[model samples]
Target: MPSPIAINPVSPSHSIFKKMSKSPTNLPASAASYLSAVSQADAHARARSLATTVTPTTTPPLSMSSSVTVFSDDNVLREGEPKMFDNDDGLSYPPIPPTSEQVFTTVHSEFGHCANEEYRFTSQHPPGKPVPHHKELDPPYYILLSTYISYMILICLGHLRDFFGKRLKPSAYTHLLPHNGYAPLNSDFDSFYTRRLKLRIDDCFSTPVTGVPGRTIICYDRETQDYNANLHTTGRRTRGLNISSYNYLGFAQARGGCADAVAEVISRYGVSCCGARLEGGSLDLHQTAERLIAQFVGQEDSIISSMGFATNSTIIPALVGKGCLIISDEFNHASIRFGVRLSGASVRTFKHNSMKSFENLLREVISQGQPKTHRPWKKILVIVEGLYSMEGSIVDLPKVLELKKKYKFFLFVDEAHSIGAMGAHGRGVAEYYGIDPRSIDILMGTFTKSFGAAGGYVAGKKNLMDHIRVRGHSGPYAEAMSPPVLTQVMASMASIMGVAPEPPKSANGTSSNTLIPYPGPAPAHMLPNWFDLPPSLKDGTEGLIRLRRLAFNARYLSRGLKKLGFITYGSDDSPIVPLMLFNPGKMCAFSRMMKQRATPIFTVVVAYPATPLVTSRVRFCLSAAHTKDDVDLILKACDEIGDWLDLKQGVGERWSLQEIMDRAVELVHMDID
Candidate 1:
C-alpha cells in the first residue's frame, strides 16, 4: 500500500489551549451572542479532546472515508437570549428589516433576508418554450490533456509507492496478506485508490461541520498528521457561506415555525416510532402526513418510510419481480440502482436525459422482449429523477411522458431534489412542465432535501399505496419515521400548502371530511389542534416567498457563472449548479480556495465515480435562504478563483465579473440557446 500524504503535521502549538482568534468587533447582539456561545462550547470540547487523546501506538479510527455532519452545542440556545438569531452572522443579515412587514423573526443564518420582491422569480417552465436539455460544454484542449495527465501521474505514482511499500514495510501489508488462512478483507485496487489517490484530497471531503447546515455552516477545524488515516480536531471553528448542503428551500434550521412544531412533538411523543409500520410503530401523524403528501403531489394516496434510501430500495422489489424490466436513466441515484439490483429485474439505461436515446432503447426492448428465452417481459418500469444531483440537469419530463404514452411503461419520477424546490407552486418536474403529477405512475421523494426533515414517501393511487404499506420491506422490517421527523414533515408540508378554513358544520356541530385538491390548502383539521403556525406560514406566504427566492438565486448563480466564462451544467432554474474544474488537483484547489476566502464559502466537489472522470466539478446547491448579495459573493469568489486556477476555458458570451453582477436580473431572464 502507498503511504498516505501528510496534510498537517502534529504539534503542541495547534492545541485548543492556545488563545482563540478575536471575533469581528461591532457585531449585532445575535451575532455576538452566537459567537460567544460557540467559543465557550469550543473550550469544553477541547477539554474533552485532551481527556480522550490517544497515544501514537494506538490504532486511530479511519474517519476519513465518510462525510461528517455534527450538530454543535450551539443548537441549545442560551437562557434570556432570543430563540431566533435573525443576525447570527453579519454576512447573512439584512442591514434593515423590511418596513412594510412585521419584524423579521427568522434566523438570518438559516434563512437569508431579501425583501425585494423583484429579486424573486417563478420556477415554472415558459409556456410554448422548448424544454431545455442538458448542455455539455467542453474545455480547451490543454485543459483536457492536463486533466488526463494528472490522473495518469497519480495512478503511476500510486503503483510505484504500493510496489515498494509492500516489500519495505511489511507490517502495513499484513491485512492484505492471507494470514491464518483467511482471505484479505479489501481488494488491491480498493487499498491502492484509497491510500494513495484518495488520501491526498481526503481533507476536501467529509469535513466535520457543526451547527445548522443552512446558508452558513460552522465547520470544525481539524488537521491530520499521518495523511488522512485519522483526523484531529483543533478546537476551532470556521463559519463559511454554505453552498454545499441540500437545503433547497432553505428549510434546514435550528429555529423556525417547523422547528417549534418538531420540538413540541418530541416533547409529546418522544423520538422513536417504537417499531415498524406493520408492527406497533405506526402513528396518526404518519397517516396525516401521507394524506398531505398525496395532496401535495396530486396522488390519490401516499406511504411514508423512515429512510429515504430504503423507500426506494425496499418498495421497488414489491413493485416489480424477476420477469419485470426497469428502464432507468444512466445518471439515476445509487439508491435507485440498489433497489433495481435487488428486484432481480432486468435493467436497460439510456443516455442521461436524452429522450431520443431513451425512445430508441424502449423500442428495441419492446420488440426484442426478454433475453435468452425472447419472451415478452411481464412489465416495464421507467425510472428517472426529476433533477440530477451531480449534473444539475432537470429531466425532460414532457418528453418522458410523451414516450410513456406511446410505449405504455410505468413511469417513476424521483423528486428528491425537485420537490419543494421546483414549480410555480413547488410541486416537482411535472408541475414545472405544467403537467399533472398523476400522469406519472409513481412519484417518490424525500423530506431530507427540500422539506428540512427526514425520511421519504411514495405517492400514487390508493390501491398501490395500500399494497406498498402491506407488502413493502419497510412495512414489516424497517423502523417507522420518528415522531419529530413526522411532525416536521407535516408542519413544513402544511406551511407550503397553507391551512384552509374549516368546512361548514351541520346543526349537530360536526363537519364532513373532504380531500383537498392538488395545489390547494390543507384542511385545517388535518394538523394537530395545538400546532399553530404563524400567520405568514399558515397562509403559505412564507413558503411562496421561499420558492420564488430559490428560483431567482438558482437562475442568477447558474447564469452568472456561465457568462463569466466557466463551463457549467444544468438548467438555469435548477438550484444545483455544477462548475466544471476538470482536473482532480483543481477540485481540491477550488474547494480549499473558496473555503479560505475572506468570507469563507463552503462547496461540494465531485470527481470520477460520483461524476465522469474528466468532468470533475464543484457543485453549488443554491438555497432560498440565500439573498441576492449571497449569490454575488459566490460569483465573485468563483471568478477570482477560476481566473487563478486557469478554469475559465469555457466558450460563451463572456462578461466581466462586475457586469455579470450588475445585470444579474437581465442575465437571469436572458434566453439561452
Candidate 2:
C-alpha cells in the first residue's frame, strides 16, 4: 500500500483554532470520516437512512480566498493543496466548512457572546425543509416568554415594596405599662386601636345653613315649600324669590299664548335632543325655529344651537380662523370673548362706545402696514352686545357702524337683553335705530331670556349661515336643536306678530316715512334719533309718547320704593332695579324677614365674587308682566324689611342715579351688582 497521504492544514494553527472556537458544532471532514469508519456497521446504516434521500449537487461555500479547495465524496483530492485525511479506499476528505453555530461559539469564547446565546441558528435550510441542526428553531418566541416572565417578577417585587413602604411602624405607646404592672390590653386590640387612630381626620363638615341663606323665593329646589326657611341650612329648606333666573320677558311663567307655545313644544318633542346636531338628532322644530328667528330679525338665514353660550363659542371660531383680527368692545359679553378666544385670531378691545379710541387703533394697524410675502390679516370682525347684561346700557350702534364701514369689518351684535324689548315692532335695538338689518353681518340672541326657551340662534347672510350650520363646533358636535321646540318658536313669533301694532302713516304717503320720529335733516326715509320728531318738529311725537308711558311706570315704582325709605339704583329706561344692602349677612336676614311677612318679592342678594363687597345688593327685575299692584306689593315688602331692621338711609349712597348712569357710559371693568 502507498504510504499514508500527507495532509496539510487549510490555515495557520491560530486561524484554525479561532474558527473552531467560534463554532464548536463544525467538525473536520477528516474527523467525520474517521468517526464514520470507526462506528459499528449497524449505526452507519442507521445514519445513512436518516440522511437526505435526494442527491445534492455540491457547491463550494463562499470564501474570500480563491486558492482554497473543497472536497466531496465524488471529487478526488487535488495535488497542490494538502488534504486532512485518506481512507482505506485511497479517498481523501478536506475539513468541513464552519457552521453558523461554530462561528457564534468561536466569537463567544474569544469575545463574549450576546446574553442570548440560545437564539443563534446553526444552519440555513432550503425552502420547505425542516431545520435539521437545531432541536427548536423558534428561539425568538422563547426569548419573548423569558422577557415577560422577568417583567412580571419585577412588577410583583415593586408591589411588595409599595405595600410595606406605606405601613406605619409601631411606637412607644405599643409598649406602655399598665397601671397594675400587667399587660394593659390584648396585642390585637391595641393594634386595631392604633390603626384606627392613625387614619387621617378631617375637621370640615357641611354646616346646617350650607345652601344660599337669604330670601324666601327658592332659586333652586323648586319644590321646597317653606319660603321663609333658611336656604343655606342643611335641611330641605329654601328662601328668596327666585328672580336671578333668565325670565326677562316673564314668558316662562306667563299665561295665555306664551304658555300654550311651550306646551306645544313639549307635546311635539320630549325635552332634550337626546344627541348633538348633525346626527339623527335635529328635528323639524329646529328648522322652524331658525325660520322664525330669521323672519323676526329680518335676516336671510339663521342657524339654531342648544344654548346662547354655544352660539358664541362655536360661531366666531368657525367664521374666523388664522390670519384674522377680532375688534371687540370692552364690555362685550363673556360669550363673545369666549368665541373670539376660540377663533385663534388676533384680538384688540376698543374703549366702551368710544369711537375715537376705535379709530386710533385702526389707524395704528393701517400705518404699520402688512408684509409683502405673506397674506395680510385683512379680515376684521367687530363684536358688541346690543345691551350690556350687567350695566343695562345700550351699545353706540351708529358709531360702531361708522367704524365697521371705515375698516370694512364684519359686525356681530348680541341682542340677549335688547331683543323683544326695543324697536317699533320689538325687532331689537338694530330695528329701533332703523338700521337696515342686512347691514349687520351676524345677529345673535337667546330664547332663554326673552322667548322663555332653551336655545339660541345666529342670523346672517345665507352663505355664512350655511357655513356655520356645518362647520360650527356646537352645531355639529353638540346636541342638535330639537324640531318640536322650533315649532313653538314659530308659534311664539306668530303670537308676537299678532300683537305688534302697524306703523302709523305719515303725510308724505310713503310706507318708509310712516312711524319714524325725529327724522334727521336727511331724507324722509332716514332713521330717527332718540327724540321722536321729524326735522320740522324735533321736540316730541308718537315715539316719545310711548317712551314716556314706560318711563312713567318706572318712576312710579321708584317713588313707591322711595316713600317706603328704600334706596333704588338703575335708570328709568332699565327694568332692573337694585335695592342696596352692603352687608351679605344683612341681605340674607332682610330677605328672610320680608318673606316671613307673607310678601313674595322677586329679588336676589348679590354677594361677593359675583359683585364687589361694597356693592352687594338685592336685585329686582321688573318686567312687562308686572302690574301696578305687583309693584306696590314689592314696595311694601321692602318697607317691612327696613322697619324690622331699623335701617336708616345712608347720607351719601354710592349707587345714586347720576353715578349709575355715568358708570354705565364708562367701560365696565367688572360685573355690576
Off by over 4 Å in 2: 1-243, 261-282, 354-356, 365-376, 499-571, 578-590, 593-596, 612-614, 636-673
lDDT of each: 0.79, 0.48
Q: Compute the lDDT of residue 560 as modeled in candidate 2.
A: 48
Model 1, 1-673: lDDT tens digits are: 3335432222223221112233234333453354455455445444657555322211111111111122234443232232222233322222222222323456655677667677889999998988866569788789989989988998898788778988999788878777789998987787876777667788888888777888778777667767767877777666667899999988888877888889888777777765433324467777778878888999999999889999999999989989899999999999999999989999999998999999999999999999998899999999999999998899998888888889899999999999989998888888899998889999999999889888999999999988988888989999877889888888888877889978999899998678777778888877777888878799999999899989999999988988888889888889999999999889888887776665667889888878878988999999988888888889888898988999888785899989987888788877778
Question: What would the per-residue lDDT of candidate 2 be over residues 1-673, giving only the tens digit for each residue?
Answer: 3212111112222221112222222222443343333233224434556553332121121111222333444344333353242222221222322222221111111111122111111111123332121111122343335435644664576445434544553243444334356775645344432222111110011112222111112322211122222122222222223334444444443223334555555544556665423324455456545655676787878988778787898889988976777888886877888989888888888876667788898776556544453456768778888866554456767767877787777889998777755554456767656677788999988776655566788898999988887888987688765644554455444434332223456688645433222211112222111112221122222222222222333344544454445555543344455666654345656654543333233355654445543445666665433333334456556666766654435333234333332332131222122
Least well predicted 10-residue stretch by lDDT in candidate 2: 198-207
User: What TM value does model 1 have?
Assistant: 0.87
- Model 1 clash pairs are 67-206
Clashes of each: 1, 26
